[model samples]
Target: MDFHLTPDEQAFRDEVRAFLDELLPPGRHPSDPEFLSTWQRRVREKRWVGFSWPREVGGGGGSIMQQVILKEEMAKRRAPALGTCFMGLAWVGPAIIEYGTEAQKQRFIPDILDGKVQWCTGYSEPGSGSDLASLQCRAVRDGDHYVVSGQKIWTSIAMWSQWMILLVRSDPAAQGKHDGITCLLVEMDSPGLTVRPIRNMSGTSIFAEVFLDDVRVPIEQRLGAEGEGWKVTVSALAHERSSIAEVEGLLRKLDELVELARASTKNGRPALDDDGIRRRIARFETRIAAMRMNGMRFLTKQLKGEPLGADTSINKLHRAALEIEMGDLALEIQGSDGALEKEIDGGRWQRFALSWPEVVIGGGTPNIQRNIIAERVLGLPKD
Candidate 1:
């Protein structure tokens, strides 16, 4: 695949770079509340938040390559996120655009792009073993509403979100693995809904267990048709997994890791000067390059209208391993100082080190991704 940007793409890249330069001057941090507010407003005005979506729905209607260029430039400059609603922009918006009613699109897509509301996904179940198809959360049709009951585990941002895209089993006797499943756009404040945060090893509760005891979701809130939940979910998960495989974010992390090594001491010398540390950093760079190339290949396939399948698992697996390795290396370089929860670097390295489980297991586990690659890509017999 050709990595070279076309003339139009190069022009777009220049425009993005110029915009970033004006928005993020060298001394100003992107995180400042004042700057962030202005940043979000400006980006939204430019319609860069949902850049790839249709312009009719308040998106930029930008080309796929242009979207890539925009993200690449933004990440390179460490710009504030294009929008405030992470999950919404990442998957929900796209899914809604594809499968939602006109009313649903008008009601939800604008809020998602304008960052007016947060959306959480209710997919995983406690004993489901990551097989979303087997979710036991049941939602039964009752006149104009569906009364949802059962629990979802590992729901990210459930406590803070205003809405949830929930999946439930509407039929237990269906013969197919994915049959009887339904997707509903549920209001978080529905009477019977409850959220309980689940603290991880890092002591953060970004994930939660969501319990719906006869929570009534209006029939109109259902995304896609009944029994079409699997299709909608598969599309949403594809968007999610692709976002997880972002090479630009990994590159930024690599840059930070390099700086960390240069500033830290290892056995009486700068950590960056240590042979082992240097080799690891080099390997990281090489792997990042491989990821970039793979990304370009995926882009090429997308341009050709080919559906990306098991090949994406390779990047997902690489990202998980790279994040773990980089986090550990940062701690190793910091040595004993890394153990302090509130030391220099603001415990950034320590936090990163402890945050590995989410990345390693969130979208899909390393083992799951490897299984996908082994069976689908390599055509190996499933065990």
Candidate 2:
């Protein structure tokens, strides 16, 4: 199969690159909360956040390959990955398009694209992380509203989000763990809702502990059909895996590592001059190339209107592993300085070392990805 971009696509890629050149910040800034906010504002001005989405819902309505091109070019330029509106654009927006009502889309999509509303995901509960189907957060219907009561942990950017896309247990006695679940679009400012920041080892409060004490959501806020949350969640996970934003971010990290290796020294010579270091970097480059090809293949499938399936688990696993490996290589190049605290010289290497753990753990654990590969890809029997 041909894997190259067409002439028109290439022209579009160049156009996107030129646009990014004008839009992205000039100097290097660490991926901190403040930087992210600034990046989001810039993205809003340029209208680059939802390039893959349809125009009717406040997007550019570009093809999936065009979206990939946009992300690849952005990453190649070291543009910021996590903008302020990422949760809304990357996860919540797609979920709404797939499962939201016409009224819901009209009400929320414009605000999302305009950067007037930010969304945070409410999937992982205090008791459910990887085993998300076991979430016990309950939402009982009360007249025209649902009284939601439960807590979600590791909610990213909850402090800044105006709305949330949540998964809750609407029925307790369903036959399967996946049954009786419902997805809801909730206003974060609703009564009885609380968001408390959870500080990470990196000395940043990016994630939060969210509490819902009888938070009332209107019946219309329910996404998909009641008791169909598992289906909705599966679709959401597919979107998450297919996210160009994350893949682009990983590619950018790889590029940054290459630059670091070229500049840093080891044994009285440039680190890139060392055979071992070169081999390691070469291996990572190969892996990243494979990842790019895989991502393109996925995008091609999307363009053909094929369903995104178990194969996405492979993309998630490979991308996550490659990211961690890139970080490891960077830390190796930094040598002793890699262990220094962030306060010491901004802890560049140390921050990467500290941040590595969450890369595998955040979206879904590596083991979970393996399980998906085993069960879905290999058709292996479950324990």
- RMSD of candidates 1 onward, in order: 1.6, 3.2
Candidate 1 local lDDT, residue 63: 86
TM-scores of all candidate predictions against the true structure: 0.96, 0.88
- Per residue, candidate 1 scores C-alpha lDDT tens digits across 204-273 of 8989999999998899999999989999988888775343237888888899999999989888888899
Candidate 2 clash pair list: none
For all candidates in order, the CA lDDT equals 0.88, 0.80
In candidate 1, list every pair of residues with a backbone clash: none
Error of 1 at 221 (Å): 0.7
The number of clashing residue pairs in each candidate reads 0, 0
Estimate, for each residue in 235-292, the C-alpha lDDT of model 2 and write its tens digit.
7766663545666666667677878888889999999899999888788777767766
